[model samples]
Target: MPSDVDSTADEQSNGYWFRRGLAGIISAPAFILMASFVGFGGLAREAGWSAGEAAFITGFIWALPSQVVFIGSVAAGASFGAIIIAVALSAVRLLPMTVALMPILRDPKRPGWVYYPASHFIAITAWVVSMMRLPDVPRGGRLAFFLGFGMSLTVCNVAVTLLSHQLAGTVSPVIAAALVFLTPMYFLVALWSAARMRADYLALITGLVLGPVFHHVDPEFDILWAGILGGTLAFGLHKIMERWS
Candidate 1:
């Protein structure tokens, strides 16, 4: 936790983001991002991506789900427009993430356009840390901290992707696949942290139950159906739970 200081004393400086950005690399949870990206790198190459392409995806796209959608669609021979639409659809989850954290990271002096580019970096690992840590960080330092944090993840992931890409041939498929599990595990834990209400708890439980069943029945649209039906069930269950109590 960080100490509270007079906000006026903490007013903006160009250097504020620089200092916090460095500190973000050493953040305790950051290794989770590194591990997740390392797995992502491995999976990308395993799925037939080149080192250059993997690095580009990590650097620019930055979202694991979007990257997965892009690669999966491309491999399935989806059309150009389809690939873009699929990737964008998979990335819909990010809007809430960006909207949720903007207040902490937005700076009045920087103008709104800067935030759009800044929002590009709002993947799950970094977003979780920002939600948790930004409140304690000085108001002026949040954007820099976020950008720096993102930079650290980007730099490390690029290197990790290259390294993992090399290892893709030598490494067993099982081992490489195991590494890729880190990202989802991070999301599950973070979801647990965020699921404080009855509705949220029900929704998570519903997803856990329905997600696999949906996949078994219809693999193509499994996740989409799981979200829709699971959410509806949870919403109904939450109402029941509310009335029962």
Candidate 2:
């Protein structure tokens, strides 16, 4: 009977991962990215780029913010050197995100080279969802789950970029452009579910409340200031709560 019970549990674990991995393929953020791609496609078309350039940019650049900066700089008649600098600056946020996420997703035995390809999938949407869900995932299944989730988003991104290029000329640019805002909106909702610690929750709330205010004062440096202020306050509040408890 004990052997039979063990077998049943194993089967259940397998089924759980199978279903969970499949669920990642059609996750909410995938749709969010699809909507955002419509805007990217529109931007490419508006820039008078061909569908190939749109596809290449989505596939190669991958980061939406960098892509947006590239488009904007080119449209404004910026020099090539300035465009490169702006796009690189827009992507500076990724370094910290990569640092935070790699340990959670990496397998010690898996060679470093594997991460080269895998790193491509570490976009904000995937990282946010993966960080939140990875603890619940069986350790061995984490990579498989992320590959499925990340691949789905990437494939959808490429497809939508190509399709958007054609549709951008015909579709309402304003509506599609507005959809790009969905990424941050979803981040707010996702953070609500994912925040477990008081410090984390407080930090998130502070960022949300003060983010627009800081941006109003200084759009260029708002994120850095908000992060510093929110993080410091959250740490202090958490320490106070711990001492009181």
Candidate 3:
């Protein structure tokens, strides 16, 4: 009986490490890079941006929605103010990520230099998953783990962007479209996985319903407004639902 318990505990520990290793393999930086090739870089080429410049932006920005808006709006000859607003709206979610993560990821004794930039790679997917999983990890290891994971993502994005730029001509448009679509598809899947609260569920459903409707009216503002409006409405409705339930 004692041996059986010991064996089971060892297996569980090994399994935990293995899973964490796998999770580190799929970093937000990597996903952001993958999205860039099919989505933004291709569009950038189409819009006359030099491949090097687009790839540079991809490596630096690592924010897909904002990059998309910046590229798309610029392509359409939008004004500086319009482009700024579009990018700003898309990037608003970054604030929430930083707020939620700082308390957990920041080490009390560590200097700001190391932690400040680790905070930069804390995107929606990374932040959400880390929030869910990092608490279970030993406090000292969380930052190290996320650093490795986030850096892997950043490096992969640059590599993949160059590869995508070179290979874009070889692939069919359909495949390219699917590759671009994967980022959002993954996001929805992540959102679904993280939906423990009623407000999150309602927000997702409402946002999906509103996305198309708002798009038809104004393509530029659709995603931004839909998320804001739908999320707000979802929050309100969730409160009512809870009170009445």
Candidate 4:
């Protein structure tokens, strides 16, 4: 068991290093989204929000869809509470992701102060790939590996965001669309590769089918309900399949 664990840790550490480099390359498209934000921010400048406020939302919110929703909804005369709720609902997907990741990326021996800053590096795309690769890593080194990998991605994201703001006009819309697509494309591929077990496969299918269906019914609650109800259903399905076999 100990030997197996050690091997797994080595694999995970190596995997993280490999993926971290790939992530940097794949994440180049995200620069286009950054450019889009700068353009939008420029437009918003005259509407009411100051440049700092625009930059803050772009930087601190960090979630593109939610940031767009918040800014657009407010611009359209939505109440503050509604805007907040919209953003919160959009980000609710992070909760399960965080739960699923904590064990894999956590160092039980380390204090909270370390993980506190480390958690900032966690993002949807990175979390998905990291989770997929983590099982091969040993528990002891997984957290440190993630810290290095995630920090790399974060630095790239920030640098791109700042660059986009400074050179928004230089980026074409086609390139921006491509960049925005990179995150999801990477995630979809990683999620597909990670579905090695029945439960995970069912969860993926359930989430995919339910995401759009629930979105049409109620955009705000779709992710939460899909993750909860679909996940539960998938779990039950997996158990039944196992029993039958």
lDDT for each residue of candidate 1 in 47-162, tens digit (9 for 90 to 100)? 88899989888888888778876876677676787677768766887887788888777766567898877787788878888898788777666777788878777778788878
Output the TM-score of candidate 1. 0.79
Please report the candidate that would top lDDT against the real structure.
1
Task: Tell me the tens digit of each residue's lDDT in model 3 across 32-128.
Answer: 4456445555556556777788778777877766676788778767678767876887788688778878777765546778877677676655566
TM-score of each: 0.79, 0.65, 0.72, 0.54
Model 3 regions more than 4 Å off? 1-23, 26-48, 136-138
Q: Assess the local accuracy of residue 2 in candidate 2 as a C-alpha lDDT between 0 and 100.
A: 26
Number of clashes in every candidate structure?
Answer: 1, 0, 1, 2
> Model 2 misses residue 172 by how many Å?
6.0
What lDDT is obtained when candidate 4 is compared to the true structure?
A: 0.61
For model 1, the stretches where C-alpha displacement exceeds 4 angstroms are 1-12, 72-90, 181-187
Over 4 Å off in model 4, which ranges? 1-55, 112-114, 170-245
In terms of TM-score, how similar is model 4 to the real structure?
A: 0.54
What's the true lDDT of residue 137 in model 2?
Answer: 63
Per-residue lDDT of 117 in model 3 = 68
Better of 3 and 4 by lDDT: 3
Count of clashing pairs, candidate 2: 0
